[model samples]
Target: MNEPWNPYDVMPAARSADPAAAGARIDALPVSERWKRRFRLIAKAGGPRLPNLGALTFGERMAVMFSVLGLLFGPLYLLCKGLWRPALAYSLIIVAVGFAALMLGLEMLARGVGYGAAVLCANRACALYYRQRVLGERPWL
Candidate 1:
């Protein structure tokens, strides 16, 4: 049996020799064009960038997806992802918002705000996780 060809085996040399191909490969990634551009910008800013969305491991992709959907499990998800600081911050914010809403007799508004905050926290967590794990960059959030 023949071994399958590995793209990485030739990537470093090919990328150096044919910049256009590298650009084409980046453009062909499964993510949106905007994200592709952002990836390039991130690379230029001295951060790591994946060659394509397919380059992400299954675990990494799942983590990001779960984080984005982490309204009910925001703190738990972040904690499991080893983002203790963010988890604590998000928990504190939710508690404070809940308390304020109760004191103001605006339970509905508080619930809405809490939901929004959860979504925002999840999004930020996803970005932070991607930067730290996939891009090999330090966490900033």
Candidate 2:
């Protein structure tokens, strides 16, 4: 494995007999490319494993940090990506944030926080969903 890292690398694709699962896997597959970089950053921050972020080139660093589709659309984007479970969870989070916004009199702040949380959670949520549906592994985040 001496080859340098490529952001467009195809992840290990898992095939399933179920058509629905197959479709979901299709959506979840691309996430690995993006999330692989993001997860490396997350892992480097004293998580389960700490990898060397300094090794990433400038382009790779940009890939790990910048994404707004998830932030702009939030859970709706998750649903479009065949991640219903995460969408549901994010919806509940929005509801809770709405309640807090009402009580705290900071509607914009609460909504902003909720949307930001979705961006942070989106990749890992996709990783977990892909593992569970495609690999038949228990999905835990």
Which lDDT values do the candidates have, in the order given?
0.54, 0.52
C-alpha lDDT (0 to 100) for residue 37 of candidate 2: 45
Candidate 2 — which residues are off by over 4 angstroms? Answer: 1-54, 64-66, 121-141
Q: Which ten residues in a row have the lowest lDDT in candidate 2?
A: 42-51
* Regions more than 4 Å wrong, model 1: 1-69, 134-140
TM-score for each model: 0.48, 0.49
Clashing pairs in 1: none
Worst lDDT 10-window in candidate 1: 8-17
Tens digit per residue, CA lDDT, model 1, 35-108: 45544443333333334445555764444333544566767777775566667787888789889998999989
Clashes of 2: 0
Pick the lDDT winner.
1
TM-score of 1: 0.48
